[model samples]
Target: MDLIGHVRCFVAVAEERHFGRAAARLGMAQPPLSQRMQRLERELGVRLFDRSSRQVTITRSGALLLEEARALLDRSEEFLACATRIKDGQSGLLRAALPSGLARETVAAILADLHQHHPSVELELEELSTTDQLARLASHDLEVGLIHHPCDVAGLELGPVLRCELGVLLPRASLLAARDEVPLASLTGLGLVLFPRADAPAVYDDLLTTCARNGYTPDSLRHGQGDSFVHGLILSVNAVAFSPPDRGTAAGSPSSEVVWRPLAGAPLAWRYSVAWPHGRKDTAIHAFADAVPRALWNTAAVSTDPPPRPLHLRPASEYWL
Candidate 1:
C-alpha cells in the first residue's frame, strides 16, 4: 500500500531536514510531500517526525523505519538491475532438447564456444528422441531442438544445419567390408541392426523409406532403442547397420574389427536441423544454433568415402577378447 510513495517522502525529508528543501529534491511542491508524509504516518499509526518552530527532527520510530526503508530501496534497485539484464538478453537461461543421434563431439564443440563467448548465459540440455522433441517443442516444454529434419509439425520452423551421408557399419571380415561404398540393395538379405521401429516410428519410417526408394527393404535382425545400444549390437554381433559417419566413434576407438562405408544410391541423406516455434525468437538461442554447424562441419574430417583399409589389421584376437 503506498510503500514506494512513503519511502520516497521519507528519504527526501531525512536527507534535506527541511520540508521546502525536500520538496525541491523530490521535484515536487511542498504541500504534496507534506501530505504524503502525513498519510504514511497515519497509515502506520505512528508519528515519524517531530516538528518545532525552528527545526524538524526524526522520532524513534522514524529512525527505525528509515533503516528498513533504505534496505528495501537497495533491494528494489538490485532486482531491477537483474530484470534489465534478462530483458536485454545479456543474461538468462536457455532450455534446449537435442536428439540422441547427435554426435557428442559436435555438442561439445558448440558448448565450448558458448561457454567462452556467452559467460552470462546459462544452458540446460535435454536429450529427447526426435518425436519427443517435436512434442516438447509444441507444448513449450523446450525452447529449441537439435533434430533430424523433415519435421512437418505445424507452427514449427526448421533450419538445416548439417547434411550427413548415411554409412553402413559392418564387421571387418564381412564380405562388404572391403568396399568403399555399397548400395542399399546390396544389403537386401544381410542381417540389419536398426532402431526400434515402434518406439520412434518417424525415424524408423524415414530409414525404411530411404531404403525403399533405392529398391530394397532393410532386413532387421535386431532392433535397439538408442544409439548406444544399437552401436553395442554392431560391436557384439556380425550384424551391419546404417548410421551417420560420426557414429564411428561409438565403437570406443577406431577399430580394425569394424568398418563404415557410405551407402550408395541412398535416397537423400539425413539432415540435422535446428527447430523452434515459428515465431519465438531468442538471441542466445539463435546464437547457439548458428554456432553449431560452424563448430562441427569441418572438425571431424570424416570423408564421404570410407578411409583406406587399415594398413595392418590387428589380429581379430585383439578385438574379440
Candidate 2:
C-alpha cells in the first residue's frame, strides 16, 4: 500500500512544518504531498498535523512518530544496500575447491587475496582432486575450482591457463642430482613417484606418455601426493618425482637429503586453470579466478606468461612404444 511512502511524506511535513516546503524538499507538488499526508492520517486514524491559514503545526502523535519514521527509512535504505552488495557478489558465501598437493603457502595466499578483494564473501574452500571437483561442479555443490588440465571440461568454462614446469626430485646422493640440469633419460632406472591415477587419470596418462617420448621410462611407478610420502618413496624405493622449482625451496631439505633439479629442456609441465559450470559464472567466480594466478605466481612461482595449449593425448596405439 506504499506504507513507507506515506510515512516519508509525514516525516517531511512534520520536519518542514509546512506542506509547500515539504513538497519542495520531496520534489513533489504540494497537492499530492497533502493527499499523501491525509491518506497516512486516515490509515492510522490519527491527526498528524493542525493546518492553519498561516502555518502547520505537528500534532503530538506526529511528533512521536517522526523519529521512528526516520529510523525506518534509514533501515530500509540499509536493507536495499545489503541486497545490492549480495547481487554484485561482494557479500555472500562462495564455495570453491582446489586440488590436493599445493603447498600450504600457496593456499594461504589464495585465501588472503580473495579476502582482500571481497572481504564479505565467506570462502568455503575445500581440498579436492580434479576428478572430485568436476563431480561437485556438475552437481552444483561447488561454484568454482582450481583444476588440473586434460580432464573432462565438457560442461565447464575455464579461466586463463598457467603452466608450471616440472623438475626432478631425487635424493641428494643420486648422481643425477649433481648435475645443474638432469636429462630425462638419465633417470631411466629409477622408479617414479607420482600422484594417484584416480586423482587425474588423463594427466597421469599424458605425463607417462611424455616421459616415454623423452627417452625416459621409469622402471616402476608409485603414486603419492603428499611431499613426505613422495620423499619417503624416493629414499626407500630408489625413485624420483617431478615437482615445480619452488617445492624444493618450500620443503627446505636439511643436510642436503633431497634435491630438485630442472629437467633438461623442461620437457614436462603441469597446466592449471580455474573452472566453473558453463553459463553459471558470476562476479565471485571471476574474482576467484583472477586471484588464483596471482597466488600461484607469488607462492609457487607458477608461470602465467605462456599461452594456453590444450592437452593433446597421444594415440593409444603409439603411446605404448
Best by TM-score: 2
Give the Cα-based TM-score of candidate 1 against the true structure.
0.77
- Residue ranges of candidate 2 with Cα displaced over 4 Å: 20-47, 52-55, 250-252, 279-281, 305-308, 311-321
Candidate 2 residue-wise lDDT, 59-176, digit = tens: 9888888899999999988989988877877778889999987778889899899888878888899999999999999999999999887778888998878888899898988888
lDDT for each candidate structure: 0.69, 0.85
lDDT of 1 at 303: 28
The TM-score values for the models, in the order shown, are 0.77, 0.85
Q: List the residue pairs that clash in candidate 1.
A: none
Task: Look at candidate 2 and tell me the lDDT of residue 250.
Answer: 48
TM-score, candidate 2, is 0.85
Each prediction's number of clashing residue pairs = 0, 0
How well is each residue in 130-185 modelled by candidate 1, as lDDT tens digits?
A: 77877888888888877754444577765544667678877766687677778778
Q: Which stretches of model 1 miss by more than 4 angstroms?
A: 44-47, 52-67, 84-93, 120-122, 198-202, 225-228, 235-238, 250-256, 265-268, 298-321
- Model 2, residue 288: displacement in angstroms? 2.0
